[model samples]
Target: MSYTDDERIRAKRRALYILAQRDHSKKELYDKLIKNYPPDLCEMVVGLMCEHDLINEEKYTEKLYRAYINKGWGKSKIRFELRRKGLPDSLISQQEEEYDTEDFIDEIMHLVDKKYASKLDFSDYKSVQRVTAALARRGFAYDDIKLALSRIKDGDYDEYDE
Candidate 1:
């Protein structure tokens, strides 16, 4: 399909409108803009946005990674999300390495404690099962979940419990 000059101009304006609210990767903007205009026009608009620094994959990746971490998401989940956004594998790998493993574990434990530690009886099998499923659904690896559960089982975090 092809777009006329007026359609192309409107596409660029629409792209700018999308960016004014939040940042988007070139691919994401292209995907959205293409719905309104032809692919070629969408590509041109994406290129223009790139030239003007309106779309940046690197900045978007970093900000998204930090935001996901703040939301207590695990590396595996965050990596999958960034990959789906069309980010380079190497960039995602670099961001993964930047996170401290120890801190990641602590974050998982904190999430567990906040959600399940208060009312659930750790001694009960059903409670443990529920907590385990919750951790897995949150994208924590089995080993990390096991370690966090073991710590609770051993009362290692007793001092922090209220």
Candidate 2:
């Protein structure tokens, strides 16, 4: 489809406006611009942005990973989010490999503290169920959730310091 030069210019302007607000994956920017512009125009605009480093997939991926991590998200959840944003598996795996089990456990613990007010009493079956479900919903691994629950239940929160 042939897009008018005006459409192309509008697409570029819209892309920069959105990028000024936040970083976006190439696909994300295309999807947003294509809502009002032709697909071809959107693609061209995204290509231009990429060529100029205005739309860097790697930079966006890393920034997004760190943001999710700071928000107490587990790797599984963060991976799902990045995938949904149209990030390639290879890039996501690179960031995933950088973190260890301890980092994930620590994130889960921080989530528990923040969400449960650091007063999770796993002694109560209901409390255990609630916290466990919460962690699972956050996309944490089964083993990580299980270990975290056991530690919290045993009042061994200090063990996560390492």
Candidate 3:
């Protein structure tokens, strides 16, 4: 079905409005516009948005990667969320490579110190298990969580440097 020029304008305006609030993946923009407009129109608008640099998967991926990392999220969970947001595997992989390996470990340790440092007791099996499960739910691996716990137990992690 052919869309009128006015409808086309409305679709474009709505797309811009959504984008202005925050950056969205190309697929995200398409999904939102497709709800109110025809598939073809939404496709056209999404295509134009891509062509004009209005929505960039790489940029969005990097932004999200940095944000989640700063928030002390693990790589596995970050990758899952990026994929859910419609980011390509290549971009997500590239973003992961762009950061140093130490950064990931540091982030994990930082999370432990900030959130679970006090209640985590290696002597208490239940306490240790609870902290491990919590970190796993946050996308941290078992080995990494164990390492962080050991570091904290050994008094190697300094939580009061702030």
> Highest TM-score: which candidate?
3
TM-scores for all candidates? 0.87, 0.87, 0.91
The full ranking of all candidates by TM-score, starting with the best, is 3, 1, 2
What are the per-residue Cα lDDT tens digits for candidate 3 across 1-162? 898999999999999999999999988999999899989999999999899999988889999999998877888899999999999999999998987656665677787778887877788999988888888888776777777777777777665346
Question: 109-146 in candidate 2: lDDT tens per residue?
Answer: 76776677455665577877777788888778889988
Identify the superior model by TM-score, candidate 2 or candidate 3.
Answer: 3
Q: Model 1: residues >4 Å from true position, as ranges?
A: 1-4, 158-162
Sliding window of 10 residues with minimal summed lDDT for model 2: 114-123
> Which model, 1 or 3, shows the larger lDDT?
3
In Å, residue 6's CA in model 2 sits off its true spot by 3.1
Pairs with backbone N, CA or C atoms under 3 Å apart (clashes), candidate 3: none
Residue 144 of model 3 has an lDDT of 76
Q: Pick the candidate with the highest lDDT.
A: 3
Q: Alpha carbon lDDT of residue 81, candidate 3?
A: 95
